[model samples]
Target: MSYVWTLGEQFEGKLRGVSFELLARGKKLAEELDTKVCSLILGHNISDEDLEELIQRGADEVYFVDDPRLADFQNETYSNVISDLINQYHPHIVLAAATTIGRVVMPYVAIKVNTGLTADCTQLEIQPETKLLLQTRPAIGGNIMATIKTPDHMPQMATVRPKSSRPLDKDPSRSGKIQRIVLKDELVDTRAKVIEFRTDDAGFVNIEEADVVVAGGKGLKQAANVKLVEDLAKQLDGVVGASRQAIDRGWLSYPHQVGLSGKTISATLLLTAGISGSIQYLAGIKTCENIVAINNDPEANIFGVSDFGIVGDLFEVLPLLTQKLAQAKK
Candidate 1:
């Protein structure tokens, strides 16, 4: 049977949250196409419980490659293995997270399999009549959203944005087949070797995973004023995000940037201070549940998408808002 395949991602022997998110999306597309949803993962010493969790989430089948060499992500070895599997199994569609590993490996695999790939896709749907995968993503620097399809390719491919969708609740009764794949020496061997992995100690919460994000923009005027944004985020037990302008000014690190070229977030509450929402900035936060904008201009673009708007000087408004929230907690 044709399958909607999702490439599962693992880090340090644990599956990343995006893996389950892809499975959820894959399940929907699979149902629309009348196919099964399959998950493929490559790692070293991954537990059977984790493999079973894939089934519980949404995967109807799980294929995993377990080897010490597969633990750290190597571009050539991973791409070759995935490409070979696609050629052998001939899945109807393939989905992967648009992460660092997925970004590096998927293009190579798509080229090897001779298929087009849509990167950073925000939405996916199966065309009713043709069963083609419709990949929707921001185009022209996030000014427009384009829907693309690979009509000629055997297996359609897409790298979905992380946090763009939530995972299905785990169902303990769900059952699926689990298969272990053993590859030849040549497929697992690669010239490139990972010397060591270094983690950045930036001392900031991962905004993509944050439930609440307080963002600042150019209107903050100076880097010192960014502390207000940080303070408010702390009050809400959340992380701080920034517009591209704030990042450009060196007020915040690139990791804190939210926009077309930066990270996409799906926070429950996104509070923006002094940000005039550009289309690029809006695209990143479109999935947020509630948006509150604090800007002096009543016609600020941010107010248009905001659930609540405060038209006043954020310099004055933020301190009072922060004080009130703190008092409420006390």
Candidate 2:
């Protein structure tokens, strides 16, 4: 048996942290299956040092596919190559991070391979007797968790939630076999090409990457009330976040949204104001070290998972909290 993780492209010149997290989970699953952990790195001009880093993380073998066509992630090209590799290797289990790349690539590959794939899986385990990959993920807007398995599939595939686990400590001394895949002539063909790339000039803060987040929701009442949440976040030296309601109301942009449809975050501290927690929202912040909730309603579901809860109007509470934080800085 073999456990394979499809590694994603670099973010800010380093491998996305999710890649390492998947490696950590892959290591555990490989042991359970009595198999070797392997990683697929698909991109252009991948370095030997990077391959070694992957091996050190957990992979016993690293497959590197370098081609100019892979420099920018085109879904067709990436999924096609990954599907072909999976077909060839016949690994027992394959995992990918549930990032934009993985979300797009894995589904396409799954269709090509005619296999079922579980997306945004929060937990993974192998059945002791059956040896099936037990995949668990939030279902029905996060109200329930569905454990799924691809019993008859050659390679059980899943996209793991980001920040669900930490990477193993890198050991520079660890070594593994590195195989370079020569792209076949047909594999290089792609239907789509990125003509131009545009970036957000507004300086958006990715809440998923923030250590501290102050998020507001519909309980904020209106767009103007959201300023209090923003001010509080600034005082706390954190990024601002919003529930789907806030984003739909145009008080926050899509990038600032956090929940099942939004980004999964593992912040050290998540302070939410005026948000009555929904299961979908809670799923995104499951890995937060500490959650602080403030709302006027005493029965707000956000308090259920919060380390601390304050039952008071956010309009009054936020200013006081911001003031106290500012005083502490003095």
Candidate 3:
């Protein structure tokens, strides 16, 4: 009846990184609140295979709904299951990853439950006075961090981007109970058909998975300079990401852009070359473990978040860094 946090488990045959990330956060939140943490897993007859790993992820209890309709991720079907589960159990706080599936389903679930959600949040805290969720996200790019809340909601919901939060040290010793939830006919519907599932090659080192990412902004000055960043990334064995400006300038594709309106990534190490680190750009990639900033402008905002900074022309610095890291590797 009284749980501090509920993790929305996203299963792709196995538990995802975001799911473990949420569990790690939930475990911390639950300890702070002196309450239990639970995870919601929905799939068709996956109770035996899926629920055990969730238990190992620091969950006090795993609430599972085994149904045929949940075989694939259908927005309506997924949202309905989540919405119904929330109404039935009524947990205090719900946290979902801002992954593509979560992006599609969380808002719908929140709207269905008539609750406000903080989208693409980077930080989360609890109000010490009232023990309420303080959801913080990037506003107007990555320039400003905004904390939000829903005053008139039962279970506060927040959707966090991947790698924003660190996962807990895995403990196979942590064990819990798995409760199978029975889904009735009302929860079953067919608005769509999933004929073929094609895995889109997420491409060279998914920026989200990269320990280090080298990103370029409009300051590259010309489309040709994007290759400089790419070459550097190749040397560093890191992925190449860009600001929306670079993509809009036709220097890069939308998939490579990192910003409020772009892909969200948090790497252990991130390098910003020629980028101004506008708030929107920061909104997407600010949670990096270590940031290296390179720009000619000494007043650039990237210096604020970067662990190390190089104030020099990128054209000079990139090739040198690339060559230096390359030589060191050999």
Candidate 4:
């Protein structure tokens, strides 16, 4: 009866970007199954302002659980609370954002609830014949795609990677119902404790939400030349990305790095500079709508998969292309 989506905490009571995307996708799946889209917002002392907005976005019902002591994140407490909510709703499907919190909590909840959980799913569909949730994920080191289903489970559970699915277009006029669920404060507190936290200036851009991405790889000779990649991305009004090698060398932020060891993105226009397009890198970005690759090597592996291929040194080509685009804009 319920397609429940979990919304994680951000700055204060704010919703993370990926949480909205999950709600939009959950709305679609709910509509397909003729069920209501219910969102479970978890955090300590979340404002009604936040809960009300989630209902407006797409959720048919909002379940808010709040406590002042629960402000800081401790995996055990949060997961236990969410699991309790699932038990009450008995939802048919449960979706979580494949974020650091969701990733840790989902696996734990799945094992506790005795259900199968799919992590980093790029695609999801309800099978017409069986009504089984067909969850798709990158398999075999991102070389192949695998679709999995838990036939005997009541509420199908899965965590989807951020930016893989776009959020529903905001409709301020949209209306829905909000239902605050009972929280077992005693149980949740006893289950977990928060000692301290560490914050890193990972980045400002939610690269997953970017419509276009320009990424650089190992071919760009030196760390100083990484600026070329950023310039091109800026020209396109898109985010900049890098390959595993670039990140490993401390040339780019870990969040900006794309490959097996990093995040996955499905931007509309993915422009690659100097990247050789290794299978691992492609695994993260294969879902892009239009891919443009530039490499000096005519026989680069990137050419085999790129929709548009340009053979040239990225140092020479990137500046020219950025200038051309800038002039066109002017």
Candidate 5:
């Protein structure tokens, strides 16, 4: 039985932070199962130095399938190659980040292999007696958490949310082997071509990746007041986040919403204003290290979970905080 993690893209010419996060989690599971943690990388121009990073992060072995066809990610090709690799190795468990690529590729591979896959898993465990992979995720509109296992399948599969776990400290002394595989020519197929790739150059704060997140809820009273939230975020060099109700009110775009139905955040500091702290809303910010909330209502639910709670009007608090932050920066 082997624990396998799928690699994601690089940040600043290094492995994606999420890849290291998954590897650290995989290492713990592998240790419990007394097996090796393996990583699978499929891309064009993959270098040995990058491969070594995986080993340093805790992978016992790294599997590489370098092909020009894989230079750009295509659903059909990635799905086919991954499904083939699963069939060949028959690993006990496979994990991927719940990013755009993982969400697409893993589902296709699951269907191809006829196995069950739990998406956006919050927790993974190995059953002590049976050595079965136990996958836990939110269900029923985040009202309940469901634990699932693949009893009938050879390899239990799951896609974990990014930033849900911390990466292990890099040990330069750790070493591992790289196994290069030659993908069959017939496996590569392009049903749809990416003619051009365009990304929005506009400043958009991805709350999930933000180290500091400043969020506002419905307590601002009017949509126009959301700018206070935005202004504070900007002053702090942080991203803007909104509750589901704020999004519903059209005060902010859906991309900026953070909650169970929205993006989960693992920011170092999370500052919220006017949010009443619905259970669903709290779920998304659970990973945040420090939480500070401001609400005019002293009884607001947000105060219960907040590390520091301010009982005051957000209209008054936001401006003061923003000014203080700006002055501190100067």
Candidate 6:
């Protein structure tokens, strides 16, 4: 039987949020193609409850490989297992999150399986006539969106960006089958050993995962003014974001950059000052919930997409807003 499969990712025994998001996307595509949605997870010591959560979210079948050797994310082993699974099952389509793991493992799997892969797709759809997986992603420095399709490949593979779509609410009544798979010793063998893992404490919040982001653009005028953005973000219990222009001027670090060339954020609230929203910047925040723009020029492009627009100087507006939030806090 044909199946639409989503590769689930886990860290330290708990499933990542992107797993459910991919399942939600898979469910829609499976329905369109008249196939069942299956979720494949590879990890050690994964809980049964977590496996069951896949069904509650939207998978018709959950196939998991739990082995001690597969504990950490070893690219060689992961690519081997995933490629072997695709070979054995011959799924019609494969979806994974475009996170660090996905970006690293998917290309290897695609090469091993002799199939094409589209990375960092923002949108996915099943073409009605041919039932092809249409993968849409930014190209040419985010100036144009390119739609790709693997017409001849058995499993059309794509890695979608996290927060590109929301996961469906859990349904306790949803019933599905969970199966355990055992891989051959050869598949689990790896050449490299992960001796230790280290985290970078750069003191910069991951803007892509923030619930609220207050960004400054070139309109902030100088590096010192970036503090204004940081202060307001601090007041709102949010993280600071920056447009490409701001980052280009070295007002903020690259980690805080929000755009197609940088990171795509799905914050609940996005507030921008002095940013004349270019299409590249807009693509990064297309999924954001509420957008507020502040620009001295009323004709600024950012105002077009903003739910609230303020035609005033950011230097004047930011301090007042920050003070008001501070006063409200007191």
lDDT of 5 by residue, 122-205 (tens): 788889998888899876545578899989986789998777777789899998888988877888877878576554546466
lDDT (tens digit, per residue) of candidate 3 on 135-181 = 89876655677899876787888888778777777668888888888
* Model 1 global lDDT (CA atoms, 0 to 1): 0.91
TM-score each candidate.
0.90, 0.87, 0.83, 0.89, 0.86, 0.85
TM-score for predicted model 4 compared with the true structure: 0.89
Better of 3 and 6 by lDDT: 6
Q: Please state every model's RMSD to the true fold in angstroms.
A: 2.3, 2.8, 3.3, 2.5, 2.9, 3.0
List candidate 6 segments past 4 Å from native.
202-204, 218-231, 234-237, 244-252, 278-283, 286-289, 299-301, 319-330
Q: How far off is model 1, as Cα RMSD?
A: 2.3
Model 1 / residue 111 / CA error / Å:
0.5
Worst 10 residues of 6 by lDDT: 197-206
Model 1 stretches astray by more than 4 angstroms: 202-205, 326-330
- Candidate 5 worst ten-residue window by lDDT: 5-14
Give the Cα lDDT of each candidate: 0.91, 0.84, 0.79, 0.80, 0.83, 0.91
lDDT of 6 by residue, 1-330 (tens): 889999999988899889999999999999998899999999989999999999999999999988888878999899999999999989999999988899999999999999999988889999988989999987664457899999998799999978778888999999999999886799865578988875555647678767899999999999999999989999999999999999999888888899978888878899999999998898788767899999999888888889999999999999999999999999
Weakest 10 consecutive residues of candidate 3 by summed lDDT: 4-13
Model 2, span 110-154: residue lDDT tens: 899989999988899999999899999976666678999999876
Which candidate leads the pack in lDDT? 1
Evaluate residue 310 in candidate 2 and report its C-alpha lDDT on the 0 to 100 scale.
Answer: 97
lDDT of the structure predicted as candidate 4: 0.80
Best by TM-score: 1
Better of 5 and 6 by lDDT: 6
lDDT (tens digit, per residue) of candidate 4 on 82-167: 77877876888888888777789889889878899998898998899987789999777667789999899867899987778777
In model 4, residue pairs whose N, Cα or C atoms come closer than 3 Å (at least 3 residues apart or on different chains), thus clashing, are: none
Kindly report which residue pairs in candidate 6 clash with one another.
none
Worst 10 residues of 4 by lDDT: 2-11
